[model samples]
Target chain A: MKFLCLECNTAMEFKETATPDQGSLTAIFECPDCFAEFAMHMNPWETQMLKSLDVQLGGKSEAAQPMQMVRSFLNQQNPDNLTAEAPTVSTEGGGKCPFTSVVAEAFQEPVEATGPVWTPEALARLERVPSFVRSMAKTGIEEFARENGHTEITAEVMDTARGNFGM
Target chain B: MKTYKDLPADGGSNIIGQVTQQVNRLQQRLASVRHIVAIMSGKGGVGKSSVTANLASALGLRGHSVGVIDADINGPSIAKMMGVRGQRIDYGDDGVKPALSPLGVKVMSMDLFLKDDETPVLWEAQTQKDAFTWRGTMEMSALREFLSDTEWGSLDYLLIDLPPGTDRLPNLVDLLPNLGGTVVVTIPSGVSQLVVKKSLTMAKKLLNAPVIGVVENMAAYVCADCGKTEDLFPSGHTEEMARQFDVSLLGKIPFDPRISIASDEGSVFVDQHRDTPAGRTLIALAEKIEAFFNHEV
Candidate 1:
């Protein structure tokens, strides 16, 4: 999608993308002629559509790895050798696009100040969950704990959350 | 006032370049494969995966290197039927190595990556509330990865076993513009043909891919003791459908309980029971596929 600056009647260039906030992505575009910047906020569905396409918002600096989309986005994968860790992306030399990091960070569970704290036992159990779904499960369990008025997430809290998850 | 065409590019996103790279990777990966065929049955429960597994084995037994892609992303069964389930896939220089069946056919399927029998394929999403908007695209991306990122080296034939839907072929054709041909599978029942005809039209007219022919699965049931064949589904509709489509009736495979048994046991039926009625037909079906590519049929 292209953005045009009405005042200058010139096309805008992609400047950078901010880290997703609550599943929404904000991309900043600047008019080449006027040097004026504008932000485009994409809702959750649009963000997901971009993620599903497996393309970076800005130009990709590095070549994509084999099965990158499946390895990165597939939740609840087999724990066998099939769970081999995807190679880490090296953002060294500042060559990688900022949107690449945004994409990676988008899937991560946000650290909220009011979120329930995980006890040692609960954290260990969360580790046992398949790595792919571990973040999602942790988020769900913490949300459940908070909803149930539990400030500290212990094994009992995890057990109580398990019922909500049908696990 | 500037227009869309006035813009040099999509504001440096280079989305088209990235997509072109994806297509180039798929074409480069498939360069070594001589023929790529898609086996599809619009109607469910028609034994399309069974036919694919046995056909790959048959071709492998004939000294032809074969690879099978379980394109049915959500309901993949080819890896299990080909006896490659639970096999560890490693990353190679080219791509992720595919699982090898007993008869040496390479196999790639979502089944190989699933955690267990009961685990369903699910993508990591912030919310599945409105997944209908992007789920199909996710599945297609998975299929594209299976096609381009698997290390299927120097194959004589690569058969893609598609899911039960008339819309699947068009999705595949979008990914593989030069897909060799399509082998339509159906039972002898008119109900089966009713849906199979839509797939036939999809492959023949809509997409314009070559229709290799039709295979009548479970055309009849062979009695083990009496050695008599009984019509399983009011026979003769497959022939009528084939005549209507102007495609050859490739083979008629009788219903053999062992075929199901073998699939459940993760064994190729044709390999273990080559002399059986269904086994013989499966082997012949593979030969017919070869001939179709060679311009002999």
Candidate 2:
């Protein structure tokens, strides 16, 4: 977890962390003496393990909202009362940690880029799936499409991906 | 070459600090609660949830502020059995408000957050393949949230209804090192006691948490029309099992058809049929539990 600059033989300091990419995370560290930077790439599983622990990469800058982990990560929550309004985060101490911006920027939701686009018909079909498993099913179908070289997701691709999902 | 111990910190991630903070939050939340009891049965279909729902209701009826946590994340039934299913929960300044039963028992369960009766609990993930690696961790985290993030607000008793399997007690002990005691449930059948004994060993010998007693559910069949009691299964093994484990046999709850009917209708059986044999036993069991906490045998 710690990085050392061989040339300078000094410990590195945490510089920044990039937003997660495909469930992976990139953290940049810089040597205090040499001013050289190094980026550590964590695989998807490692990133998810950290998320499961509910810890920020650089460190927690703000106190967590009550049930913040469940509220932020539970994909198919009961929409009636859970999504009514965003609860105000208590900022009693007001970001005293030095890595405030680093953690705030690091935890943003990952954005999918250049992935297979879902057609209206395909999306409508996906809506019929049970809300709890819909996110996982959609991820599976999209991954299947990418593996099969399907640029655009349609009903046909979903049907072809059904066998892979054993649905 | 400097080794891992030579490094000052884990590059400022401070994972240990975060975990300690979570533990501290749970401890602080539980501070207001006097006693934390876990209701567990290693055998499936032994009616652990039903016992938990009634015990919580019984305590509430006795003027104790009670809360119930359905720790069976995948198979949560305490909310339904306690008549709090589908109740809307809101976030308060302290934590997420728990669903209130008709008896005013605070209840939290995965069932409250689920979409429908048919929907199973599933976490959002990139892929379902090899989920065994992280699924258990996710469940533990969810359980932690249920413990520390619910606004229980000064309770006399917090009853946790645990799912089947001998492995569950270890998980609970990890979360609650100061778990007050455990009440193990079993049936008269030798098969049921076969599994319940393992849980007794786990709670008494392995984990060393106090074993309150053993409850023998479905000990006899109380006929509705004839008003006659008959042996439901091979009776008397539960008493022998308790003796073998050197724990008290708390009570023997008869298999009253009304208990099932009331549970299906989201009603408490003891509230309606207090004079019945099963109801009286349940009420007395609640008193025994209170006495255990008061240092009175």
Candidate 3:
């Protein structure tokens, strides 16, 4: 049967077999040209469909979002997967991804509110901060249990719509 | 390619839990000591060990029971300076009970552990990891095991004489739980000032422990014959830096030949020269330090 490499857009052939109880739950298929290994549990039909849609496969492919691809692969592998029992992704301060959620929450709040307040200037400051320095600051904050004391910088630019007039 | 490894076939969920429980137990044991202060210097030759020994002595004289652990694995001047030089440490059932000075401050150092005075701790990353980690781990194991297994009874302070720079001291700080604060020592010079800033930044970055303040060593020289104060190195930078960092400016200790003599004789300056400037400054610093920890500042 014909199949396509999910990582590389190369056409390939596969030998069809009856659902012999393959001891391993995971399926491993090797690409002839690229010599790249691809693993998935999709049957011949689904592989053909994906190939027809021009989906690329293998090492670090940019075909789709990795997590989405993972989810799709899981769904195809087993409908009775245990991911359904996985808790909802929390974005609050207590969530696993607390920094992003906290920043988002801080941005949403007004300056005088109970939560962390950030100005546009502060956002620019965050962007301007080197990743290493930011990491150091973050580590310091966590280790010392201190506030995120970053001062942001911003500059005013004239808008084209406003022209020469001041807004 | 994404590398994925499965859990051990043993499938024991208790490994992480057991390890965590053990670590928590260790932390509790370490927290038994009321206060632990690491004495650090930005640069070597700034009299860090001398300051630590004297400060511990001053604290001891003040009726506060203090333990001095010399964390300088490479150059341990504490044991010798404290007058317990060449004394062999006896390991009891509990742990290594640090030898006591004449003033009764418990002292421990890497020197005590070495077989010979010439034995060098030539530790490398491939051989012993970073010098900091090796020294720090040795210190933690020594101090923690000492505190936990031994009969220290009740103690007010555990003063650690840390190695020079932000480099080695941070590692020791990491191992020490519930560290009261740090006393950063520096000489009165631009180079020392730069190094002190590095030390300050290191303390801020590495640990959350409070900085007691910047203690300026060799602040000035007083000629005995002339009876005039001369600025040996640049002055006021220590105080200025302390003010900038929002920490106290402990005190400036003058360069005194008498201090060197006292240290050589295995005695503290405070005991030898009570009225001398360095001795008096240390006493004042002790008082202020007491106030700081006691919340009377």
TM-scores for chain B, listed for all candidates: 0.98, 0.98, 0.85
Chain A only, candidate 3, TM-score: 0.18
- In candidate 3, position A153 carries an lDDT of 17
Best candidate per lDDT, number?
Answer: 1
Native-contact fraction for each model? 0.56, 0.38, 0.00
TM-score of 2: 0.84
Query: Which digits, one per residue and each the tens of the lDDT, describe model 2 over residues B162-264?
Result: 9899877777877998789999999899999888888888888666579999999998988888889999998889888988988999999999888888898
Please, what are the lDDT tens digits per residue for candidate 3 over residues B1-297? 211122121111122332233245335544557888888876888889999999999999999887887777567789888988666554343233467889988876656544356655432111222334233443434333333333344578888887776766555554565778999998878888788888888887777688888798889998888868999986778888888788888999988998899888897888878788888999988888899988997
Looking at model 2, give its docking quality level: acceptable
DockQ scores for all predicted structures = 0.32, 0.26, 0.01
lDDT per residue for candidate 1 within B179-297, as digits (tens), equals: 89889999988888899998898788766578899999988999999989898889788888889989999999999999999999899999999998998999899899989999897
Task: Please give the distance, in angstroms, between residue B136's alpha carbon in candidate 2 and its true position after superposition.
Answer: 0.9
Local distance difference test, per candidate?
0.80, 0.79, 0.55
- Chain A TM-scores, per candidate, are 0.54, 0.55, 0.18
Regions of model 2 farther than 4 Å from truth = A86-105, A110-167, B206-208
User: Candidate 3, residues A8-61: lDDT per residue as tens digits?
Assistant: 555432322122121111234555577675454654334323222212222111
Which numbered prediction scores highest in TM-score against the true structure? 1
After superposition, which runs of candidate 3 have C-alpha atoms over 4 Å from their true positions? A1-167, B1-28, B122-151
Q: Estimate the lDDT of model 3.
A: 0.55
Q: Which candidate would rank higher by TM-score, 1 or 2?
A: 1
